[model samples]
Target: MSAPLLEVRDLHKSYQLKGRPALEILHGIDLQLPAGECRPICGRSGAGKSTLLHILGGLENPDRGEILWKGESTRGWDRSRWAIWRRKAVGFVFQSYHLIPELTVEENIRLPAMLAGVPLEESWEDLLDEVGMTLRRDHLPAELSGGEQQRVAVARALVLEPELILADEPTGNLDGASASAVLDLLVKMVRQRQKSLLLVTHDETVAGRVGTPLRIADGRLAGNRS
Candidate 1:
């Protein structure tokens, strides 16, 4: 078997709160994700699921531990290096649909590729079509529906074709129909691209759709079930 596409070892993170002992959010998280696997992290509110996702995506630093991308240690990398890694190797989807209101759907989808210096013409049309937003490609975030905005975010996340996609509560704000539609699109895209996915969600039914669900509690990975 080949090495995992992403690996986390002994991961730890904490923050100091005013007049209190440091609050440790994650404690020695160890996980390995092979290429093309869609894994869900399920937990109750305040279980540190988002923090772990941020750490894994290089958005936040771990006080202790290591993250290896394709077997390369990410420790001690500066902000610029981390930024490049994020642009080149990771994509993030958030429940809030973090699309810039000023940018059109096509522009939003092209931003990451542009940051990575990928030519605009290379992925614009294909990505828009893939997310079924080609017809709405010229629309701004505010003009789109919740599901449409999220779909644009999904397209943007895939524009760079990163090895791993990290999503935090991706369907949190949508109605049941919209949620199911968006989730289905996300799963289909991930599978078709053969990219690894680690999603943080509260819905057990949604979690069951992934390859496996890993539960987190008390700052630790509790259990993994198929």
Candidate 2:
């Protein structure tokens, strides 16, 4: 069998308060995500779900243990190396959508690809079509609906053709119908591209839609479920 796309071992993280001891958020987490698979990490607030996702996405580091991308350890990689890896190997989607309000949908979607040195004209058209944002390509984020904004975010995330996508509550800000639409598109994209996805969400129905569902409680991953 081939190696997993991502492996995390003994991952731990903590933050120190001004007048008290350090508050440990994650405790010895171990996870393995195979290539092209989709997994959901479900948990309530303060469960360290977002923290875990950030660590896995290379946006943050664990105080202890390591994250292995493909087969290489991320421990010794410097900031620049991490940035390269993040750009080339991973894509991230967040609850807030985080789009620059001033930029048009197409411009926001093309930003990541441009940063990665991919010509804007090369992938923008195809991505806009894929995410059903072709009509709103030139619309600013403020002019679009929540679902539209998220569609643009998805397009941006995929512009780099990353091997793994870490989405932290990608649909959290949308209404029921809009959230469902966003999730459907996200799942379809992941499956079609054969990219691994790890999503952290509080919605049970959303978690159930993934290939595998795992819960986080008290800083530990619960048993996997179908």
Candidate 3:
């Protein structure tokens, strides 16, 4: 059988506090994400949801575990190798919109491609339209509403056409209407592009709106709900 798109086995992470023992975050997290699948890790604040997501996305390292990409272990990869993989295969959508204040909306969307040394293809324009931000492409992030900035963020995430998307607290700072709109746009775009999504959210409503819901508490996956 073909391997899963992504998998983790016995994942563990801990943070060292000053003059104290390490505080464990993830306790042997095991997960498998199939190609084109969407999964949500639901947890309260400080429940280790974000840690797991960051580790899975290669932004952080786990103290003990195997992060497998298509059955190949990433344990031996160097920083440059991980960076290359992230650039070519992964995209991230952060809660804060993380747009460069100096860059225009279109510039922010195209930044990834430029960094990856890939050409700005015609699909770039389509992505703007998909996120309903084509008309605002020239505006700075501060000029847009919360929802509009998030729309641009979504466009930025998809601009690279990566196979995997990691979304962290995607709607933590938005109001009800704006949050709903951003979540809807994220799901629709991921589905339409046939990309895999691993979303970390504390809100149960947001979790339910995504695909399968996996609850995490006290550094472990508590349960899975359909």
Candidate 4:
């Protein structure tokens, strides 16, 4: 068996709503993932699935726990450290197509590498071709359909070739057909890239196709082990 690429131990998180007690979201979440493994998480609305994804992606902090990336702890990582880690190791996709409307599809896809101060990858064109958006490369987000935009988002997520992808409801906003297409594209891309995927979604059909199905409730996962 291979070693885990990422691991979380005894993770806990909570939030304080105004005038209310601290509401715990995650309760001692322990997870592990090997290279190229896809882990699908399903939960109802407000089930803390997104919270776990955000924490795993380094976009949010855990109140208490340990996140180990290749056996090294991220306990006290500063913003710079987190930024570097994100640029080099993590890719994130969201329910919303967060493309910059001002940028062309090509530009939007290249933004991560640009921000990371890295030159465009040699595989840049390959990614564009993979997403079947080479013809729309110069079009702005507004010019594309919802599915096209999501295809672009998936391409952008893979542009940096990050080792791990955290997708939170990537198909939520799309219609049935568009969601199916996007979901298929995402799964195909992840498998082709050999990247680890931790997907948070509510759709059973999508979950059934992505990876091993695991349920999340109150921020804890069931039917999932490592």
Candidate 5:
């Protein structure tokens, strides 16, 4: 059998206060994500859902544990190494569309590829078309609707063709129809590309639409292996 695309073992993270005991956020999280699979992590606010996503995407570090990519451990990897890997292997989408207000749609989507020193070839156009943003290519984030801006963010996330995508509350800011549309597009794109997805969401309906639904409570995966 093929190895899983991503693995987490005994993952733990804590925040130390200035003069108090450390606050534990994650408690020995163990997970496995196969290629071409989508996993929706559902939990209440402050349940460490976003923390797990951030750690997996290299935006933050775990206090103790191991994260393996295709069987290679990320232990002891320096910040620069993590940055390089994130650029090439992981894509992150936030609830708030993090597009540059000044940059046009095309520029926003091309930013990752540009940072990675990749050429702006057919892939750019292809992504714009894929996200249905071809006509909005020249518009700024301020000029687009919430759903449209999120679509641009999604395009930007995929610009690098990363193997793993970590999305945190991707539809938190949109109405029902727009949220559904954006999420459907996200799932379609990731599945068609065979990329692994770990999405953090609070809405049960949203969680149910994704592949596997995992619940997190008190910093531990509920009703599943911890």
Candidate 6:
């Protein structure tokens, strides 16, 4: 493939397990995510899937590696630089749906734009329609269901027209039906928007739906290179 939209190299992380030796979380993880590809990086519970996602999203730092976004190295980036990178190039979705309780659907969707100093436009409203949440645009997070909240979250992530989206268990909080719907909507948005997606999930079924799975086992990519 062409130069990846995001490249993770030699990533390593560890945490102190209470009363035990430092527990390693990630071991030399290297993954390349190209533009317009929606791929799942999966592992069982406690397999460091979220860690990898967090590092890739710039929410956390890796101990020993570099992340290249659009061929620019992030290793030397200060917090401010990382923040700017996140606002412009990276979007994130969490399992908890992270919607602001005080904001309406449209307000929540526009949050990223506000952070990036870009005003929301009519096209963003069209994004709400595309995500099947146009009717809930005026509703608050508390007024919406889990699936509805997730839809808004997805729209929020897309508002900045980010090149890459890092979603950590996007469907973990929803039911089977809701999960299916959310996954379908997310995949559609990724394809239609031509944005790359790195989805972190524990469910093989969920992982299978997006793309080929890169399994993480014992803090390493299990049997897969990238």
State model 3's lDDT.
Answer: 0.90
- Residue lDDT tens for model 1, 15-128: 999999999889888888888899999998888989999888788889999998888888868899999888888889999999999999888998887778877666568878
Candidate 2 residue 29 Cα shift, in angstroms, is 0.5
TM-score of each: 0.95, 0.96, 0.97, 0.96, 0.96, 0.95
Which has the better lDDT: candidate 1, or candidate 4? 4
Candidate 6's residue-wise lDDT over 137-177, tens digit each?
88999998899999999999988898988899999999999
Residue 71 local lDDT, model 5: 84
Candidate models: Cα lDDT each: 0.88, 0.88, 0.90, 0.89, 0.90, 0.88
lDDT, candidate 2, 165-207, per-residue tens = 9999999999999999999999999899999899999888998
Pairs in steric clash, model 6: none
RMSD of 4: 1.4
Candidate 2 lDDT: 0.88
Best by TM-score: 3
Pairing residues by index, what is the TM-score of model 5? 0.96
lDDT of 5 by residue, 60-129 (tens): 8898899998888989789999999999998888999899999999999999988889786786799899
Clashing pairs in 4: none
Off by over 4 Å in 6: 17-19, 223-226
How much is 183 displaced in model 1, in angstroms?
A: 0.6
Q: What residue runs in model 3 are displaced by over 4 Å at the alpha carbon?
A: none
What's the C-alpha lDDT at position 198 in model 6? 90
lDDT of 3 at 45: 93
Give the local distance difference test score of model 1.
Answer: 0.88
